[model samples]
Target: MIAQDIVIRPIITEKSMQDITKKKYVFEVAKKATKIDVARAVEELFKGAKVQKVNTVHVRGRLKRQGRFEGYTRSWKKAYVQLTADSKPIEFFEGMM
Candidate 1:
């Protein structure tokens, strides 16, 4: 898959945003995307923010049943990107009520 298709979306949460203030950003990424790909994508998307490090995790799908057949939530990858101290953090969602 192309780099554009690798990153699904940023995982925006109060805790994650707090992390962002400290130079970390979490993202829900494609299952097959590697750390290098994630780092590159974030660096590109965030407009020159230097990527200090990239960490990826594999989250297993959860099994569930709704009074009938069982089903599983889709598995996904989570990436925690650390920005360089000199780089500014990205703020796509801020100042919102």
Candidate 2:
């Protein structure tokens, strides 16, 4: 898959924000994408950034009920990308802070 396809979007949350200081960023990635794919995607999407490690989590869909009807939310994959010490941080996330 292409780099943009591999990385859907950045995951910005209170917990994710805390990780930013450690040079770690989180993203919503394609379910079929592997750790290596994520590492490469991040490097290609964010200039001047080097991925040191990639960690993934498969979040199960949660069941929701609206009155009598019930359905499950969409399941998705999350990637935690850690950058090298000397690498520059992702400017996209910096702007959110």
Worst 10 residues of 2 by lDDT: 88-97
- The lDDT of model 2 is 0.95
Indicate the worst ten consecutive residues by lDDT in candidate 1.
88-97
Candidate 1 residue 90 Cα shift, in angstroms, is 0.5
Q: Per-residue lDDT for 17-68 in model 1, tens only?
A: 7775678888899987888888888878778689999989898999999898
Report lDDT per candidate.
0.82, 0.95
On the 0 to 100 scale, the lDDT of residue 40 in model 2 is 92
Q: Write the per-residue lDDT of candidate 2 for residues 1-97, one digit (tens) a residue.
A: 9999999999989999998989999999999999999999899999999999999999999999999999999999999999999999999999988
